[model samples]
Target: MATVENRQVVLERYIEGVPKVTDMAMKIGKIELKAPKGSGAFLVKNLYLSCDPYMRGRMRDFHGSYIPPFVPSQPIEGFGVGKVLDSDNPDFKPGDFISGITGWEEYSLIHNTSQLRKIQPDDAIPLSYHLGLLGMPGFTAYVGFYEICSPKKGEYVFVSAASGAVGQLVGQLAKLHGCYAVGSAGSRQKVDLLKNKLGFDEAFNYKEEADLDAALKRYFPEGIDIYFDNVGGEILDAALLNMRIHGRIAVCGMVSLHSISDPKGIHNLYCVVPKRIKMQGFLQSDYLDKFPEFLEHVTKNFKEGKIVYIEDMNDGLESGPAAFVGLFSGQNIGKQVICVARD
Candidate 1:
């Protein structure tokens, strides 16, 4: 077996509030390019890594989350697309591409292949899309919009964090379902992308809106049939106020509260009863049984030009920390993916 130097993004310490690049340090370690005999593990070279908002929860010392916290001084784990190099597992073999939870490093010895999917390479779809458009974020948007939102044709839908990884697809899926889709993003650029590139019916810069309630009213005067709440805070309150009768709210993310120590409460709880809105929070992990169906739907639509996905890629393993921290500040335009290595 050959020994190789592996460069990894290691967490220096568990964090509080907003994350900083200094909290994670890049370190070099050596690994044998082989999976141990009878270990049921496969060694892989990570190609692309996903930087998602949920990773912030792992940076804290909380164990109550759906996922476990990152162990400090180790390479923090996330979703990645990798190429198998050596395998002690019969299901995976050398030269196969797989996507699942892997370390933020050059090479990973993946132990649990239970959730991992073997990718049959398609030239029409980029391999990196496995971490974004065809992966967890895409699946989140699918399950949330179709299953949670329970959307109907001609319904009015509003998506917060609109141009983000999950929200972008939500808005598009709503449009495809014959609904009026609107999205709210932080910047004018993201707003433009939402409306023009992603085909949302309308988009607004949330930062420019002084009153979110008024903003929602303006966009959804008849009231929103579905509200994809990505940034919970004032936006959620506003959505609550504007929800039509029997409307549904898919609570996707809380990027707004990651940096806040003292977060404010939503003031529109009473509206839920009066409006009869169905609001639910979900984890993509919960709906693992539906992954194959989701993949088939997305891939077929994507191949037929009925669906499109956008990604904001940062190159190299060394850039992982900065790319991750940038999520809090909304620096990346779309799905933030770190290209650790390219085949």
Candidate 2:
């Protein structure tokens, strides 16, 4: 079989503090198109690669996280959509469309077939949505809100990083559940996107708010009943002060503290005692059994125009480093995706 050139984004070393594009380098390598006999690996041509904040954790040498750290001088692996080119595994065959964890490269030879999921294409929905709305981000929002927060109608819901992948969906889901929804983003544009485009009842630029506690109080006069936290730090501390009795806080990604050497402690955790609040940290994989139900509901809402998904697409493998780095800086307006190939 002929060997083809494979372009990849490789981590140069373990990252400290916030990540930069310089931390990763693009390298070219060659690979055979076919999976070797008895290898049990499937060869796939990656289509869209997702750039998520969680990936920042993998860039470090941390051992406590659910996913392992990225190996130095190797392709950074994350969620991506791909089309099968060859397979030694019976479960996946040539031309099969799948989305899961794959290397940030033009093509990947996946040995762990269990992580890959077959994509049943819907012409009405773009295939790239598999990396965002119909995929992990959407599922994360679903599980965090329903399973973790247990939101009810007429409750006040607030989402940090509101214009982000998971936050945007959580706010929309809160609104759909007949709860009052509010979101906070880093910029005015993203704040506008939340209130104007994403149907959040209220949205604010947290960077502009000098007093976050006052900001939360201004938006939620009755106190927030459900807080879907994405960017943890002072915002979480402020939210704790404004939470109503028996309020629930779903601890999702803490992007603000991810890169901090010594993360600031949350001072208002004592409020949880007085309010009888429930704050829980969760992972999407914990709710895998509910994926089928989540897919059906979210897909239906998407097709009916009841929900909207926004994505910031950076084209080519060359753009992967910048796209990944942009997450920490809040440079993306929505879900950050790198389009590596169409097929």
Candidate 1 at 260: error in angstroms? 1.9
Please list all clashing residue pairs in model 2, or write none if there are none.
Answer: none
lDDT of 2: 0.91
What RMSD value applies to candidate 2? 1.2
RMSD of 1: 1.2
Model 2 residue 250 lDDT score: 94
Residue 85, model 2: lDDT of: 94
TM-score of each: 0.98, 0.98
> Which residue pairs overlap in candidate 1's backbone?
none
- In model 2, which runs have C-alpha deviations exceeding 4 angstroms? 261-263
| Residue range 1-343, candidate 2, lDDT tens digits | 6799999999999988888889999999888999989999999999999998888888889888777899998999999999999999999999899999999988899998566699998898889999899899999999999999988899999999999989999999999999999999999999899989999999999999999999999999999999999988899999999999999999998743566723667789999999999999999988899999999999999999999999999999999998888888889999999999877
C-alpha lDDT (0 to 100) for residue 301 of candidate 1: 86
